[model samples]
Target: MVALDVVHASNARLRELGPGLVALFVGGTSGIGEFTLKAFVKNTISPRVYLVGRNASAADRIIEECHGLNKDGKVEFIKADVSELAEVDRVCKEIQKKEKAVNLLVQTQGNANLRGRDESPEGLDRKFTLNYYSRTRFISNLLPLLRTASTSPPNFARSVTILSAGSERAINLDDIELKHTFNGMRCANHTTTMNSLMTAEFAVKEPSITFSHTFPSVVNTGVARELPWWARGALKVLTPFFKPFFVGADETGQRQLFHATSGMYPPLKPAAGSPVAAGIPLPTGTAIATGSDGKVGSGGYLVNWNGDITGKKLVIDYQAEGVSKTIWEHTQGIFERVEKINEARA
Candidate 1:
């Protein structure tokens, strides 16, 4: 696995990859997305950023902060509840109307620790809607704009999802919504699984877009604090061990920036002589490579916290049987249903 220091070196080489680019970040008002957005604006010059969030004040603060740091990049904030389909559609449509092309789309809106199953007014579970459905909906609606922003020949548009690495486990396809059984850990695992499935599906259908699902190592983001009091107490005890080895917020942001702009992860193959540095830390456990068609990466990458791309593991211990296909079909069905329901309401 590549070390963070090496990833920083590669990041230096990727300085201008994001300049003058149009990036849309959902969940950028707080947490990892916010941290990464800060890094991008500080690191890159003259970029236009679209920051989407649920809070107007937080968005405004982020924009002000970006402008204060780098007056060159233009920042726009769109207030939208990402869990809702209509809001996603509206915001995306508005963005498309304003910008001719969209260079990067980052999805980091879902929260794992939802206390209970809360269904949206549209008859979809609120957590699933935010974690999976809304993300795909935004991607589907923004494809035209994404295609417009495509860099020909070598550079492809980028799509990135911030998913926990825990997704590499067994998922019951029959109960994606987890109505029968519900808990924070289970929800978190499912979120990661959905992200992996959706990412693989996107990779297959859209070769022009680079798809990445980064499993960020533990960073002391207080995301655990957002959990139940007891869980937070438990995690607090573990923070000492986690922090030293954990990827810091800035590093996480930088790694994500690498994924969003460096064109490193997708097409599932690194070009010759590029010699990109690895991004994850050592002991980055083995990863199963997904092929260009979403099988597994032969030359495929298991992204580490440091940003290096490593070879796939000898044993893919996870149960991937039909998971990808099931996720694809289920996701598409959700989108179709959401669209029709939204249209009918309209």
Candidate 2:
């Protein structure tokens, strides 16, 4: 586990990195995303942030809090239901209209649906769409902006998805959506595995942008709110008893900020000799992180909640089997089908 002191120390350097950082936080109204945004506002200097969520009231409150922390910070809330692929595309386009480049794209937009499989109007699983498809769509549409950021001032761009990472299991390619084999645990596992594989593919394809799929490890983010009433009640009762074992919001925020800014995960080619990019410093006692491809700093990282590389053999074995390419192709097919359906409806 990466020490908390180290995480704190590294995050402290955000302010010293200077201003003009642009970040987009999907699902920042509450939970881990909100906590991370607050930590970032407190530590950074004059950052321009765009908060995307469904709740305008919550966004208003968050924007107010961010402004209170850094008066110079610019925070705008774009209201949208991220579960829809079309809405995800619209939000990306909106961001594109105002900004030429984005330094950080952090996505934590998902819910734990314990009842059963729910399908959206797009004929895709709702939880799967929110957790996987929508997030991937955002990245695909914003690739231009991210690439622009990669070559611009900060000279690096990062995409972080908060989900299960260390525990990647074999995905049934025959049934990616788990049509026949549908359950809460299976859905979560498949989405997370897909996340890791797709992130690896992006890393290999872009090389300029750093992609990370991280497991936040039992964060009490109210992810269970979408679960059935009985399950929600169980969580409410169990949470108080299990609170000591869980990571706090503040620490998770700091660690997330560290993941975004620190040198542990750098671009594929680090400015010739330097291990990391300009303006970012490596944390003490933390060496260059090994990528999902098994090379040190190859750009894609599967990180654990404690800010360490997952270092799982499952990841290595899957990559060796060329699963990343399979995932990319499968994801592209989903996008095409979804777009066709949207066009038909239009």
Candidate 3:
């Protein structure tokens, strides 16, 4: 496990690379996203960040706090319900219209709900869409900006989805959306599994860009607020039983910043002058992380909360099962169909 001190020191050195790093944080209104946003602001030099979520008041408050921390950096809040694919496209367009390059894209959207299959207007499950579809849509639509950032000669554009990376359970191949079978466990397992496979595919397709799918373990982010009162009571009563597993918000931000900017997880193709795609040069003795494909620097990584790669066995096994191909085709098909519909409507 990577130590906290190491993570902090690495994050502290982010500003050394210079300023004007453009970052977009989807679902940055609260929880892990907001924490990372604050950390990103404090560490970077005049970084331009786009904060996307439906919480305007919370976004305004977070933006205010970010400004206080780093007056030089700018945080623009785009209020939208990103669980919808169309909204994801709109947000990407807005960002693309303004920025030529996006150096960092961190997505910590999605709420794990026990509520039954809540479907969006687009006909995709809301939980699945937020955790997987919408996030990927952002990447696909914003590829031009990310590609522009990739050409920068170091640290090709990076996209990180902070979700369950280590947990890989088989998704129903027959029902990719869990339409026929939707349970809390299945929902959690399927979305994360899809994310893991999709990241590897994206890496292979866009070897110039770096992609990381990470599981943030357990965090103390007041998740009880969303649950029913009875569930909240149970959580409070049993807090001591699992409290030790929870990492505080401040430390989560530090580790997340490290994961997002660290050189250990580089793109498959190294840039000139910097062979490692050299993010913030790996802290002393910290080796480069292995990719999901079991190769060093294979462009895509499934990371743990502690700044390390998830086991390659699952990736290898899944690819052998042809799950990766299925996932890519399924996800891409949805994007294409959605684009066609949207264009026709326009």
Per-candidate TM-score against the hidden true structure: 0.82, 0.95, 0.95
- What C-alpha lDDT do the candidate models reach, one value each? 0.67, 0.84, 0.85
Model 1 alpha-carbon drift over 4 Å, by segment: 112-114, 151-154, 228-241, 268-302, 308-322
lDDT of 3 by residue, 87-136 (tens): 99889889988999998899988874569899876777888889999988
Candidate with the larger lDDT of 1 and 2: 2
Which 10 consecutive residues of model 1 have the lowest summed lDDT?
274-283
**Better model by TM-score: candidate 1 vs candidate 3:** 3
Q: Which is the leading candidate under lDDT?
A: 3
lDDT of 1 by residue, 38-133 (tens): 877777658788999887998988899899868998999998887888899889888988887777788888764747877776777677777778
Query: Which wins on lDDT, candidate 2 or candidate 3?
Result: 3
